[model samples]
Target: MFWASVGFVGCILISLGSNIVRKTVERILTAQVIIMWFILLICVFTLTSMNDWIKFFKSLVENFGKIPPDISWWTLASAVCFIGAGGISNIWYTFWIRDAGFGMGSLIGKIPGWRGKKTSIKLSGYLPKPTKENMRRVKSWISNLHKAFWLVFFLMNFLAISLFAVLSNVVLHRRNLVPSGFEIAVVQAEIFQSVAGRFGYFIFLFMIAMLLWGTQLSICEGIVRQLADTTYLVSRKVRKFVKRDIRKWYFYLFILFAVWGMVWIVLQEFFSELIKPDFFLFLSANIGLISQLISLVMLLYFQYFIARKYLPKRLWDIYKPHPIRTVILLLTACFWGYFVGMAWMEKLGLLS
Candidate 1:
């Protein structure tokens, strides 16, 4: 609970800080790097020796194909869902928090005194009353933090998503004795192939599409989009993002990304029935777990820095860390970090 609160405040601040000039450039460069790497990955995946690649896939299929499907599906679904929303929903989430409020102590202190205070962008009630100095410092720190974190955020995203996609695809393959690989493909290709096929899958997926566009998804996306874009709104280079999506291009980008997710589903369908499927499922679980651990670590670091800079001297004395609390924090960090690191090393085939 303590950590979660701290993390939330950190995310809100990072979202706010994106207003700085340097951070603006940093985030832009980071995006370009990710796009470049993905392009390179397309080339590599395309140019690789098919014969050798197929042979490797064949061996993987044979080995993992041994696992039972009952377990792998759960892991694969959760992992991809976790990492797939990384870069996109992350930005959206910031707005949700901002909308709620900032300056935790102030907010909490006010709650007991007032039963009916509400906040909005137009109202200014939700925002903390900013002093001249804090505003200047926050604006500066946030600018730098915005760029720094987003760069990390984007780059980490590439690593996280690549981990997720590959892991989930691999997990689905070796699920059973029944050749799910080609069978699933046939099922999908059937959807576009003929009438019965079209209704069988297309209608079903379309119905699923209704759910995709329904209230729950909308609420979730709303919160996430608002949060993620918060940083951009605060940044000096905010105009760049606005220019890119002037008619609110981000909303369109959100739709495009959602549709592209179908591509991931298709790829999984093609490979799900292969051998050694457990290999990928295990990877997915490990990756999701690791990603969460990274979130924990980053949030902690982000909060530590913010407290140092923002908290008042009197407030700091009141909130001073006790010796036992300090030890607990250190131990918790070490424990999660160790496990995630272990899983990562295992993924590289480095463990005994």
Candidate 2:
């Protein structure tokens, strides 16, 4: 608990320091993600046993229906729902990209908190009239955004999740060990120890700490940005409170969020016992599933209706998703929607 508290405080400090300088925050997160990938690579090569992989595959083929009785369907559903940022965290990408000065985001000013000089843009929400040159620029920006999405978001997450799946199956599952609560990090660290000795355990611990630190920092920064942006966009009266300085609003939100998190941590045991188990599971899985469903609808609507209608013909031709891609997106959405419906029915005692 002490170490967790220390790590949490360290993350909050990093976030507070870097909140003003977007580049610094980006660099810190990017560096930690890269380092984590390297650590995963080391563990894959040195720690995982080939025999365990064989057993894992064999079990999948021969005992596919044998899910552990202790693991509820909601647990599996929640894991699946989180695949490839299909949860609320998926929206954080938009926040990061906008603040990083992508597309129309370039026209809007950024919140320069404490570490950076304040910047102001003459045009707040307006975009310059679309000319052929502007259309071409927009197309280029969209293309670049696609590349970044695939490389940075999709591929990295795929590789990281795959590595952990392999580690779990080969190192932990083979021993009938399950990571629960505080044991999650410890179990993962043991994988390194098993292969490389006590030193590897320490290395893995450091890796875990660094990863958590980066994640918490990013979460804090992203949530504050989202809240401040939403508030500024939605309510004029609330907007007056910040005096048009998003930095001030962000800081206020960050402080509130920090206090809330600290209080939750301090009274976690009491809350844990007060909240029903099923209720927590329902929130974890269904809320994220609903968010993903909404995101998919908004994405499809933007692509098929808004973009197609507003974009220049040439630019639309260049940037529009291919028919196959659209079909795939629709299918994916439907698949998740089905699972979400089933989960909801089951939760409501309407389904067996």
lDDT of each: 0.43, 0.73
**Model 2, range 237-323, lDDT digits (tens) per residue?**
756776666666677787788777666666664677875545554576677887888888899999889989986677677668889
TM-score of each candidate? 0.38, 0.85
Query: What CA RMSD would you report for each candidate?
Result: 18.1, 3.3
Name the runs in model 1 displaced over 4 angstroms.
1-95, 101-227, 230-238, 241-249, 270-285, 315-329
Cα lDDT for residue 104, model 1?
Answer: 34
Highest-scoring model, lDDT: 2
Can you tell me which runs of candidate 2 are displaced by over 4 Å?
49-71, 119-132, 270-272, 275-282, 311-315
Q: Which ten residues in a row have the lowest lDDT in candidate 2?
A: 119-128
Expressed as tens digits, the lDDT of each residue in 176-228 for candidate 1 is 32335235434433432343444444543443333223322433345435532
